[model samples]
Target: MQIMDVLAKLGGESGFALFFMQGGWKNLVMIIIAFVLLYLGIVKKFEPLLLVGIAFGCLLTNLSYFLGHGENALYHPEIWANFLDPQNTAAYHSYGYIMKNAGLLDFFYIGVKAGIYPSLIFMGVGAMTDFGPLLARPKSLLLGAAAQLGVFVAFFGAVLLGFTGPQAASIGIIGGADGPTAIFLTTKLAPELLGPIAIAAYSYMALIPMIQPPIMKALTNDKMRVVKMEQAREVSKTEKIVFPMVVATFVILLLPSTAPLIGCLMLGNLFKECGVTERLSDTVQNALMNIVTIFLATSVGATMVADNFLKLDTIKIVVLGLIAFAISTVGGLLGGIVMYKTSGGEINPLIGSAGVSAVPMAARVSQDVGRKYNKNNYLLMHAMGPNVAGVIGSAIAAGFLLSVFG
Candidate 1:
């Protein structure tokens, strides 16, 4: 009778058995989705640097549900539930409680909760950015600013769809096509939606090549698409060194809430341009960036536990995110057409799509589309002007929303 009792306890505790008893089909579906993401990241090379980590994190979080209620599980939904409550005054205390009890995944998540990882990632991006294109063609800033039209449009769309003000703001930022910005805003306004928003942002960012080309072709005719921009005036090294400081000072003074993100971005740019901090710049651009990407991607993915992620809300977020992206692309293209007309055919409308802020990816798509029309027409440098400007534009827009809702 004792031996039978021992066998019964072992069977009850086994993860294989608990999988069926606990989350059931939802867990299985999430696990399969995780594997599909892994396959896309690894085999198909879809944003492998971040997606692989995200997929692994998703796998681990879903697997925790099968492990029975124990310390070995990487996530605790009950603990997470307390933090999700918007009005919970003791959210910080609950975070501390999770840190003391839960496993290492929860520990890494502190960076997300505290909004550290996004700022760090922005710093790294700044370290890698070259402001020469933007400085040479300051007019591109208008295109960048114009592209953000989608963000506001999506905000109203989300609000009309029955989301709260903060949640609507979070969803609208997906139009910016900036993953870190989306994560940063979502963490502040709607922490619970962080996973889906991050995934949607990055997924769209990776698909920029595929998504933007069709839109670019559809929006601009053959004549406008093939227009070759004049060579940008050479930007002096002193201008490059001074631009970050001036822009950072101006934007932050105008909107103090953007200091954390825009401040770090300019700091990294200063490290690069100052010519005295090559070591720091290199580290920020490469080593520090890689490390933070791992932590940020994994923490984001871990938030997508089956129970919370498999809801109607997640589906809505996904749909809304896609719509936001499409609208942002249209806004950028429209802005480009205006510039094309204003410049009297000197400006290629293709470069305008770079205003969506997918960095080099959006810029590259612009270049590719231009190449299809005329082989000698290179739009990379010109597109880059709006590409980097879009980064600053999105950050400023996020600050505006945060001031109002956060």
Candidate 2:
């Protein structure tokens, strides 16, 4: 009788037995999804740095949700749900309560909820980035701004689909092809939708090589793709140093909500451009970036607790994200075409597709496509003008959306 009782207790504690319970299936399903994401990140190498961390966090959160009982669970959704509830005013955005009751993920999530990680990530990006290309060709700013057309288009589409203003804004930012900005905006406006938005943003960013090529080919003929121009004029050290300060002051005055991201970005850029701050620049570019990425990715992934992620809304978000990304590419290419015509075929329209802010990757795509048509055509430096500009454009667009909706 004693042996039988012990055996029964052990069986009840097992994961298989838990699967029979209500809502247990959702956890199991999420775990499977986490496994698939892991495979994609590890085997396929899709944004491996962040994706692998996110997948692991998802796996850990879901597994702990079931394996641990009550207050001991690695993530407590109820805590976050309460944090967002108006009725629980005492607990609303209350980090104290979270720190007291929630688990490890909840602790790491503080950086995410407080908007620390993404801003720091921007700082790192700015530290590594050289705005010299943008400074050389001021026209690249037009292409970058034009690429943001998808953001507004997707916003209106989301509204038509019955999403609220804030939700739509969060969804629209995926068009920027900037994961940090997307995560930053979503956390502020639609915390509930963070899981879907973050995944969509990163996935589309990783697929830029595949997604942008078709759009580039469809929009441009051989002549447009092959056109190359003279080298950009050199940018002086003074222009590089003054650029970040002037932009930060002007932009922050225009939209105070942008101060965090824009300020940090410009500050990082200043560090890189300023001759004295080599150590600071290197730290942000390497160590700080790597650390913050791990925290941000894992925290974002923890939100993928099955019940929140497996909805029809998730599918809708994925589809809309793809549409927004495609449209942004189209918008950039169109802008490039206009420049090509206006310049009497001196400008290569293929370079315009790099205006979606995926850093050097987008610019490289432009170079690859341009090379395929005319091997002598070197569009990389020209394409970089718009590539870096897209980063600023996306941040400004996010600031606008936040000003209106936040």
Candidate 3:
């Protein structure tokens, strides 16, 4: 009996005795959630480029205690958080990570603590994206604007729920279907909510085909799906090259704050346009973009550990994210329908759904749906107009929100 008691005492003393800050219930739940995200990213290939890196990071961040790292919470910047420490005061006055030893959060905070990395990612994105489609069809810019009705509408919805104006705005921008925009806005507004907002934006962007087709089919009859579109006029190489520069200058002059983001996006297009910079443009679009994406994804997921994301708001963010995405799709589809009616159906009604900034996926869905009923239907060229416009419109809406609630 004495020997057994000593053994039990040692077991209790050396292992598994720390009280979980949030309790075992939340701990178990969060681990399972992280695991699911992992499976989705790994096994299912759902946005593998991002999801995998994020999943791995999340797996690490969630274990309040993992591999003897000795963490009991996400982080504790308490020396500074305490606000009364002499050593910390001098430390706080200095620039950069004085509280580096505080906890696991220090690293996650590195990616999102300031708005720096997201903006860098945007520069890379700008260096990659092509503005040719929007340039070829300027009117599609109007459709992009229309699709943003969802961003503002969702912003209001978040506000009614007691989020600050900036926080609400960050959540709503996820509807823009642009990952960098979501990250950029959240970095300014609610950095705490970054994980959900980014996860939602990227997830839904990848799921565009899944989310959109049901909405599209319901809003239009079978007859509308088969409506043929006029062939897009041949775009001159000169026109594609000049389009990004013109749009960028016009936009920055109207809304200078967006210049950092919008400027980069257009600049990338310019690289593609100039022809002389084909090598640079190709490198930006391919290699540089992929590297940035991996960094962005891993850093974003590192924020998703159990402590931050297992809250009620995480669920709210996800649920509201879907709502926001649905709204954008409807807005785009309605815009397309109106355009079709106004143009006497010359525009493929299918192209309207591409107004969500899911880029090529939404555009491809338009083609797929069109082909479903009409085998010879080729809607890809037509869909490019609104597809490109959606990116610009999303950026503008972000600008409007930041200007108002920023």
- List the candidate 1 regions with Cα displacement exceeding 4 Å: 1-4, 66-71, 84-95
Superior candidate under TM-score, 2 versus 3:
2
Say which candidate scores most in lDDT.
2
Model 2 segments more than 4 A misplaced: 1-7, 66-70
RMSD of 1: 1.8
lDDT of 1 by residue, 39-103 (tens): 98899888888889888888888877543465567866666667666677776447676777676
Query: How many angstroms is residue 324 displaced in model 2 relative to the true structure, after the best TM-score fit?
Result: 0.5
Q: Which candidate is the best by TM-score?
A: 2
lDDT of 3: 0.74
Q: How close is every model to the real structure, measured as TM-score?
A: 0.96, 0.97, 0.86
Model 3 / residue 156 / CA error / Å: 1.4
> lDDT values of the candidates?
0.88, 0.90, 0.74
- Itemize residue pairs with steric clashes in candidate 3: 126-265
Residue 227 lDDT, candidate 3, scale 0-100: 89
Candidate 2 lDDT, 76-117, residue by residue in tens: 778888998989988987888888888999988889888999
Clashing residue pairs in candidate 2 are none
Considering summed lDDT, which 10 consecutive residues are worst modelled in model 2? 64-73
